[model samples]
Target: MARLNVKPTRMELSNLKDRLALSTRGHKLLKDKQDELMRQFIVMIRKNNLLRDEVEAELIAAMQEFVVAKSLINESFIEELFVGTETNVELNIVEKNIMSVLVPEMNFTTSEAEVSSDVQYGYLNSSSELDEAIDRIETVLPKLLELSEIEKTCQLMADEIEKTRRRVNALEYRMIPQLQETIRYIQMKLEENERSAIVRMMKVKDMGD
Candidate 1:
């Protein structure tokens, strides 16, 4: 590292020493923060993975039921049923902080006054498979929303981890090293000057004797 441009004096050495102390302390704190963020990030990733697997399995099962229902029923009837149905679902988003990262919390609400049952279609014209499919689809709704929440949280945590990693690296590799080198240079220069002054004083005393 390049030596800092400063006078070879005791005051400059003291000042550089102080700066180095502060930099060292700051580095430790930042490293601790990075460690905590990493721990939180790993937990989020695990949750995301589990939620994704469960949601995918549920959706696949629902799709199979839908396919069976389609095979047993008329396509026009299925279309007509949806066309006559009115859906009123509202999504509200709330946020909370985790390790300084903002993550979304979703609340899914359906109008109970308008939508009360899982089966939107009538029983007379639809097969049992259709009803099963409808029930499974309804069961998947909250899980799907939960999956979305976890995935978004994972993304936000990942970003924060990366940012923290950068800062830690900068301090550990670059800033701390530079401060140490500058402090060392200042100390060495001051010592050499002090030695020179002592030698000059001794020679002058010898001449006077």
Candidate 2:
């Protein structure tokens, strides 16, 4: 590696050595952080995958039931049945840190102006299939929200891991090696100066004798 362009002095050598020590230490710490972030990222990704699959399957089943209910009922009545429906949703968003990366945590409380079920309209007017579909959708809503949180967390963690990897590589491959080379150069220069001083003293003694 190309050594740093610096004066080959003891002070410069001491400075370079200190820098090398810090760089190596920083590299170790960053590498550890990167590894932990990756581990957590993998776990979240797996959870996201599972949650996505479950949510999709549930939604599909709910849609199938809705279609069946639609076939049995009149279109206008279906719309009227759902008219004026209101659901109050309160979502709580917060951040949690994993390996210094901030990811979101989401929770929500939902209350309906109507009852939780379609029983408000009575069973005679509404088909069981419609009720089943609504229940399925309600059950999957929380899972969908959870899936969204995990996906966002995974995205943020991936970004942090990439940044940490770059820093670690820069320190390990570029900064540390350059400092070592510069320190060696300064040490060699100092050794040469010492040997020259010894030679001059010996020559003076011989002349004196």
Candidate 3:
């Protein structure tokens, strides 16, 4: 803890007293902000955990479907079918501001299934299982992206909350109290000097008389 360098003077002391009062008020308001941020951060953390679990489960299911599709269909046939099809996916990243934190936004064009043609290549036939797998993957992509955004946002909020809490503690427990103590000490010293000067002046007047 760094000690504050407060020069002891009447005007300086008055200023410090005012600063102490202001710091005390600021400390209270900061505490309230910290509490509110903590509450929101905790809620987001809980949601992040739940979303992570759900994403993991969905990913596992999607992988299983991919494996089944691969086993049921021939690789070369699938390759030929997709060769002329456009598989280029474009994703747009947007930003959302939450409590001065920027979070990620994911947006994409429609899935291949929604925009695919009815043409077939060689002896390849697009099965319902393949369509199901593609649909499920498409469904999970946006949710996974959302979960990622939420996790990052929660982390940022938690960090900010911790910083605010530290500042509040410093003002409340250290800075404000020290300033008040110094102000009291200065006031007492000033009063004692004033009383001593009055006594000295009275003695001189009595001697002159």
Candidate 4:
């Protein structure tokens, strides 16, 4: 660590001591914040990982079920049944603060959220596989949205954690050390000057005698 460029005097020394104390307090505060942020980040990342795995598995299962349903029916009929259907979904994102990081919390509303007891189309041509496939996809839709929210939150938290870590490091390894070194240097200079002044005073008295 390097000493700050400052005059070696009682006033400067007092000011440096105040600065060093402030820096020490600031360093401790930043370090505590860093630790708390890391804790929050780890919890969110683990939740993201688990939710991602679940969403992936469900999506794959739905896709596989759809492929089987397609193989058992005419592709044109499948397209005609689904292509014109409108699913109105409204998505809203709100920001939540976690460890001083603003992350997104998502909400969604679907227009056709109700389950129909009666089949929309004739059951004569509809295979059970097709019905099951559609149901699987419908069930997984909310989970997909939840996974999106969790992933976004994790991303924001990671960014915040990295920033906090940098600040903590700067205080612990750079600013605090520099302040301490400069304070020590000023103290030494002041002491040496006092000794020199005392020697001059003795020399002057002996000369007068």
lDDT by residue for model 2 (71-115), tens: 987777778777746677789999988878889999998886433
Which tens-of-lDDT digit does each residue in 142-191 have in candidate 3? 78777977877887887888789789988888998788788887888788
- State the TM-score for model 2: 0.91
Span of 10 residues, lowest total lDDT, candidate 2? 113-122
For candidate 3, what is the TM-score?
0.77
lDDT of 4 at 134: 79
Clashing pairs in 1: none
Residue 178 in model 2: lDDT: 94
Kindly indicate the candidate among 1 and 4 with the higher lDDT: 4
* Candidate 1, poorest ten consecutive residues by summed lDDT: 113-122
lDDT of 2 at 101: 86
Candidate lDDT (C-alpha), each: 0.80, 0.87, 0.77, 0.82
- In model 3, the clashing pairs are none
lDDT of 1 at 156: 85
> Each candidate's root-mean-square deviation in Å?
1.9, 1.9, 3.4, 1.8
lDDT of 1 by residue, 40-63 (tens): 878878888888898888788888
Model 1 residue 91 lDDT?
Answer: 96
Error of 2 at 12 (Å): 1.0
Question: Comparing candidate 3 with candidate 4, which one achieves the higher lDDT?
Answer: 4
Q: Model 4: how far is 9 from its true place, Å?
A: 1.9
TM-score-based ranking, best first?
4, 2, 1, 3
